[model samples]
Structures are given as C-alpha cells and as structure tokens.
Target: MLPLLVLVTLASIAALYVRGDLNPILCDGPCGPQYVTPPEGLATQSPDPDEAAAVGSGPIDGRELAAAVAGPLRSEALGGRTSLVAVDARDGKVLVDEGDGAQIPASTTKLLTAVAVLDAWGPDARFTTSVVRDGGRLVLVGGGDPYLTDAKSKGSSVERADLATLAAATAKKAGRGPVTLGYDVSLFEGPEVSPAWEDGYVGSVVAPVSPLWIDRGRVGAGRSTDPAADAARRFAELLRARGVEVTGEPTETRASGATIATVRSAPLSRIVEQFLADSDNEVAEVLLRQAALKAGQPGSFAGGAKVVSQVLSEAGVDTAGLVINDGSGLSRKNRISARTLAEAMAEVSSTPRLGSILSGLPVGGFSGTLENRYVRSGQARGLVRAKTGTLTGVHALSGLVTLSGGRPVAFALMSDDTKDVNPFVTQAALDRVVAAMADCACGA
Candidate 1:
C-alpha cells in the first residue's frame, strides 16, 4: 500500500511536470508564459548606432508595480524574507512592491557596491599588487587589486602565470642574487570571509570569495580545510616554491597608500559591467569597500552600508523598508523590498551614472547570470536586462526591460523563506511577468 502511494505521488509530480505546472516556464510557446508583444515605438532589436538616445527621466511609479509583483510573489513559499524592486531606468519609473526590507542581499548587494565605487573612484583607477625591493627582501604588497591573474580575462581566479610573470619580472629587475619575496596583504583589515558570512558559504569555490588575492579572486585550485587566509598563505608559499625566493615570513600586509608595482583593473566601469553581468561577489565586495573609502569612511561592510543609506537619503528615495547587512547581499540578514529597489533603480537610471549600472546588468538570453535564462522567451530574450539573486530560499531578478514605444520598464521580484522552490521556477514566473509587461501597451 505504501509503495502504491509513493508511485501515485511520483506519478502526480510527473504529471505536473508534463503539464508545465511543476517547474517554472522559460521560453514562449505552449510551454511557458505568453510572449510579450511590443506596443509600437520600441525597437525589438538593439538600438541603431545612429539613433539619438532619449532622455526625460521622469520618476517611476514603483508603488503600483510593486503591488502587482508582490501580490503573487509573497503568496508563494519564501523563507519569510523576500525583496523585489523594478525601476524603469530609462524613464525613472518605479514598479515595485513592499516586502521584508532587511533581507540578506547575497550577491545582489554587489550592484550597489559597484556603482558606489565607480562614483567614488573614477573608472580608470587600478589596484596595485606591488613587487617591492625592501633591502635584501622583495615584498609583493597587495593593493587590493582583484584582477591580478595569469589569465587575460576577468573572473579567472587563477593567477599562477601572472604571478610567475611578475616574479620573473622582479627577478630580472633585480638582476642579481636571490631576493626574499614576501606576500603582503595589509590593505584589507580583516578576514576575507566576514564573520557575518557563513563558513560553509565561504568554504565553497563558487563563493570562492576570499579576502584578497591577485587573480580576480580565485582560490588555489584544490580542496583544503584551511581558512581563506590559510589559502592565501598556501598560494604565497606555492609562489615561493616556484622559484620566487623568500626570507621573511609570508604574511598578510597592512600597508596603505604605499606603491610598489601597480596592476590596473579594466576600469571601474568595466569591472562593474562584468560584475553585474556575472554577479561576481568578490568584485562587488571590493567595490563596496572602495565606495566606503570614497565616502570618507573605512572601506568595510559597515562603512559601505552607511554610505548607501546616505546616498539613498540624498537621492530622495524612501528607505522605509530597507536594511542592508552587506553590499553583496550574501547575508541572509540583508533586507529590501521591491519598492525600495525600484526607487533606487529609477533614480540611478536617470542619473549620469546610469552607464555604470546599466552596462553591468546581465543581458537577458545573452550574458552574465542571465546567460542561460530567458533564452526561449522571445519577448524577454534580448529585450530584458536584469540582475539575478538566489539563496537557499530566495530567488530574485531585478533590472530594466525595454518594450514598445521606446519605453523602458524596471521590475524586481524576490522570494524568500519558501519551501523547495528553485530559481528556475522563480525565473519562469519573472519571465511571465516581463512577457505581460512586454505585451502591454501601457505607455502607448
């Protein structure tokens, strides 16, 4: 009898899967939500190179959109913490709903951090991981440069070749005798993984998020029981064994405003672009700290949060239902609502700094976190640009979606404190919502 019951349940689940009720729908067809049809003036493809950009940047009505998105979102199984906000970046429209404010941002907090950093430090700024000749000892001082890698690309955490090259360059520059090489990581003041960051989360490579490292924040390629700092030590030691001589202890440095050798990143704008597109936590954290520093505060989580609050207040965005634990949104304690995010999105979109934020967004059906998402949904495929967030019980996508009439719509949807709901499901729901917007001729 028990076996039969199990079979029945399995059969029902299968039936739901077949009926498109069990999983979130992605593409437009009989399987997914209806395709959103552009109203009139909106371009279905990329804007023509010769086209003049439109600017009016009216305020977005986030409250209305929030109501629509939240009604269905919260009705689902979230982990009692959820946030969603959508802002029509082009026109400064807010379409959002109110939910838990201080929910953990996870990687989503990276967006805020990235933008603030760009604003604080011009895009051309480069972080320096210096190779200094301190008497008989050669020290590789870390300037918190996140992109010192052997690979000629962003997000490639492996910097063996690059480190090797730098070491070789240093050796060649020295031109004689063995010089002791020391790895200095004194720029950052604490552990790579924050006390607020979960240990298990920090342990993984995906979160391979570290305090500071050269190669775009990649951990050494292996499994280890050591903490993040330990990994840094091992990496440094590996460099040493690789023919880079060392005499002094391999330790984290605490030097500031000191220059040895500088390795510039691919512009702050580029970093932010990749960050939003890839949803990189390490880049986000660095950017956040940089922002704090820019805002005349310590470049730390707490400092960044304070800066964010100040920015929001100055920008006249309502922070009634907002709590930021960390800029990366990795914290489960970070809370935000669709309304707040929408407001922010709208304002940022209208500002001259829109490029930093918009350029970073993952193009729907193309790159970044949304690379594999919304591929089949024709209306949302190339038409939607957004950021995606996911945690154990949370799934969110927020950004801009351009529709007909050259009108852009912003939307954020988040689900937290839920049971057994995957990101795919939430993505399906979001796709449907975007499709609905696409098909609507609201402005037309």
Candidate 2:
C-alpha cells in the first residue's frame, strides 16, 4: 500500500492541476526593464563576434587607442566632462586613462555586486526557502531567493522556486487540524527602503528589499507594502486549499521548528546572468546581501556596501575613493573612478570562476539593455559585451570589447555632465568611441 504521506501529496497535485493552478506563465516577462526582444533575424543565441576573436591577441598600441577615441570624446553631445579608462584584460596594460577621479556609476554598479557575490559563492551556489513546524504552528522562512515565485515554473524566462511546489509537500506532512502560520523575515537588517531613493522608486523602480517575497512583492501592477506578510498569507491559503486547516492570519515572528518542506532557487550563475543581461535590480540587491552574509556581516545596505569594497580591494582591483551606497547603483550617492570600474571588469574577465561576470552581460546592440543602442555601430555589434549605466545626467558603459586583431580589453566610459545635451547624441558618440576601438588593428 502507498504511504499516507505520498498519497496525500499526490492528491494535492491532482487537485491543483485540475484547477489549472500549475499553468506555466510569464512572471518576469519583458516588462519593467526586461524587454529583450531579439533584433530582427538575429537571435540572442546567434554566434557572437567575441567568441571568434582570439584571446591575448594584442599588446595594445597606446597612441593608436588615444587617437581612435579622441574625436568621439570631444563631441559636444557628451556635455562638458567625461571619464574613460581602457585596459587590456590579459596582462592589465593601461591603454588610455582619462578621468581617474571617482564618478557616479548608474546600473553598472551591478557589475561590482555580481563579482563580489560570485566570489563569495561560486557559480553553482543556490538559495533556499523552507518551512518548519513547532508544536501546532508552521513557519515559512526565507533565505534570500531572488527568483522565488508564487506561480508555476517560468520556463527560461527565469530560474524559479515556486511556492505551489512547497505547498504540495507541506500538505502531506501537516495534520488536517487547525494551525497558525508564522513567517520569519529576520535574515536581513533594517531600512527596507533606502533613504537616498527617490519618492517614486518603491512602486515602479523596485519593491521593498525583503528576504521573503513572491513575484517580487507585486500585487496586480503595484508593489506590496508588506511582502513577507503577503507571502506567508499566501502560504496559508495554499495549505487550506489542500485541506489543511489554517487558523488566523499569518504573523511575523522568530521561528524555531523541525523541517517540513523546502525548495531552492537556481544556481547563482543563472541569477547573475539575469542580473547583468537584464539589469535586474531586485536580484542585484539580494546578491549584495548574500555577499554581506558571507563576510559575517548583517544583511543590510551598510554591511553590503562595506563588503563590496573590501572584496574588490582584496581581489587587487583599485578601490580608492570608492563609495558604494547601494548595490543596484540606483542611488546618486554611489561613486567610483572610471579606472576603478575598468579594473573591476578586468579582474572578473580574467578570473576563471567569475567568467559569468562578463559573459552574462547583454551583448551590445544585440540583447539586454543595449538592444536599442549601437544601431549606428555595425562593426561593434555582437563584439562588445558591457554593462550600461544611466541616470538623469549620467551615462556610463563599462564592459569588454575585442579589437579587430582579437585582443580583448575592458573599458569604463562615463559622462556625468550631460544635462545640457541630448541623450541620443551622447549615446551615439559613446557608440562611435567603441566602434573606433573595434576598428583599431594597431596591436601588431
């Protein structure tokens, strides 16, 4: 005879399946900074130019690189100031060093967070969400799974750990009697919302940085004010649906219980891929916390920022005058020199364990944030893989590009004084600068 637990779990699955509750849906679809439609006939997985370019093909010609980038840098579209640093990724040879002072970096800050987290936990590391029972109460504890979902599998849209699966497993173990559900959100420290954030950020830009959230704490089209409570409540509803009597509303409390059911998110490599390729702010913030926890620090803004700098410094990336206020670079307070950003890129590019830190970045003009960009730089298309940064007056691109001679170089380009200039014109100029570099075959 089949065990009662196995029979109960099977029954729950059939019931949910019959109701079509397990249908695969697009949760993280191309909405809100994830719109990555392939450019016409070219698919995202098409053979890339970088793959064909041989590594270590250059002893870059400093004077040639300077001459190649000079005209584009002087464009009036760049406003009054620009900072640029380009270095060979293989041997760390400085090719062109233009502003060496710390400057504001926008979404490109995800690069630093990606590198730190990847170093702390290798590409195969995963986050787990589990449930436990103490007496008659059940507690749902979150361990910072960024891709935790309340729906069914998301296919390739994302790496998901669906709560429905957990619900099915839990229903088999718990008794059918009434029981209270509790949730623990003590994994992360205070200040759920950053003080430096703009007023409009919470609802649209991102939701609160909670360790426990479903669908990134979304309710319809808006963000949830209390993601953990909402998640716990959902768990209770699922348990009840499976014939397990849930008592009152789920409450917040420190939980100590025996294991009941658990689920784990995809590997950290896949997480970092989504982060860089799509510039996923939620994942970036969660990864920063993971980095902090690895350093034995509290999972909060301050602790994460401190660890980011320390990790980079210890990796031999120059962190002088680097001020990291947040992991997503959404804050205007974050500052780092272009040279520092370039060095960080080089460090990641050369390290074997952190290869995704570069490979996962969106291909310029082909995918990710750069899909609409580089329209005018055909020669540079599919050749450049870089993280883009943008704010009101700041536009930055820090990434890797291979030359016509097959030499790979990491570059950081920032222009913060573009308030008076048209954004398109500045971006075009930036693209042209990279195109010029790609055309330079002076490595011989």
List the global CA lDDT of all models.
0.58, 0.82
Query: On residues 239-353, what C-alpha lDDT tens digit does candidate 2 reach at each position?
Result: 8889889989999988897989989987787788887887877778889999999888889988898889889989888888898878899998899889888989898888978
Instruction: Give the lowest summed-lDDT range of ten residues in model 2.
Output: 26-35
After superposition, which runs of candidate 1 have C-alpha atoms over 4 Å from their true positions? 1-104, 151-161, 205-211, 220-245, 253-260
Each candidate structure's TM-score, on Cα atoms with residue i matched to residue i, is: 0.73, 0.87
Q: Could you give me the TM-score of model 1 versus the true structure? A: 0.73
Per-candidate RMSD, Å: 12.4, 8.9
Off by over 4 Å in 2: 1-58
Error of 2 at 221 (Å): 3.3
Which residue pairs clash in candidate 2? none
* Candidate 1 lDDT by residue in tens digits, 32-131: 1233333232236444433313422334345444444444554444445555555566655445444455454456566556656766776666565556
Give model 2's TM-score versus the native structure: 0.87
Q: How accurate is candidate 1 locally (lDDT)?
A: 0.58
